[model samples]
Target: MNLAENTLANADFMIEEIKKKLRMATGSALKATKLNDEQYEDLKDIYEMVAGKTQFSISEIEAITTELGRLRKA
Candidate 1:
């Protein structure tokens, strides 16, 4: 595979990982309180953001992961 294809594949994998994490988090939160309309809206927003349907690119997963690392470090 070429560089662009490899990069896209990595991004897709990262997106899937993020979706999995989000699902876990949302599930835990739901166990606490049934997802209200606002909560569902927030989850949808998060899904769009991570899935790159908004102003983000699929490749942005790397940047996001990096930023998360930095936040954890701090």
Candidate 2:
């Protein structure tokens, strides 16, 4: 759970945590394996932002989901 490392496992951890914290309705669509490793830093940024807060506006969730979508592997 040492997310400071940029490993695939860390990416998976961050993705799962983000999904849980966001209570994403389409969580299944955002699996860690589907994400691009090159975008790990971006994902980490999102994860940190999400983790620091307990609440989110509808628009904020949508925006984060969208950003995650953009980071998905093609």
Candidate 3:
């Protein structure tokens, strides 16, 4: 494949990895917190930020990481 294709493939791989992490974290957090409204809202926001309304992108993954950092501090 060409350079652009290679880069896109790598990005896709990373996005999938991030999605897995998000799924596990969100599920564990919800289970531990018992799906409280606040926690659910947080997870929903994270999911939306990471995955967007229709699709996931590299920028959205970066935004998700940034939001996770903020959440960690809070």
Output the number of the TM-score-best candidate: 2
The better-scoring model by lDDT among 1 and 3 is 3
Worst 10 residues of 2 by lDDT: 29-38
Question: Pick by lDDT: which candidate is best?
Answer: 2
What does each candidate score in C-alpha RMSD?
Answer: 13.5, 1.8, 13.2
Q: Can you write out model 2's per-residue Cα lDDT over 27-70, one digit (the tens) per residue?
A: 66666666565687788899999999989999998899888877
* Sort by TM-score, top down from the best: 2, 3, 1
Q: What is the lDDT of residue 66 in candidate 1?
A: 57
Candidate 1 C-alpha lDDT tens digits along 1-74 = 23123243433344354547544332221221233344334434444466554445555655655543333333
Clashes of 3: 0
lDDT of 3: 0.45
Q: Candidate 2, 13: how far from true, in Å?
A: 0.6
Q: Please report, in order, the local distance difference test score of every candidate based on alpha carbons.
A: 0.41, 0.81, 0.45
- True lDDT of residue 7, candidate 2: 82
RMSD of 3: 13.2
Cα deviation at 65, candidate 3, in Å, is 0.8
- Pitting candidate 1 against candidate 2, the one with the higher TM-score is 2
Clashing residue pairs found in predicted model 2: none
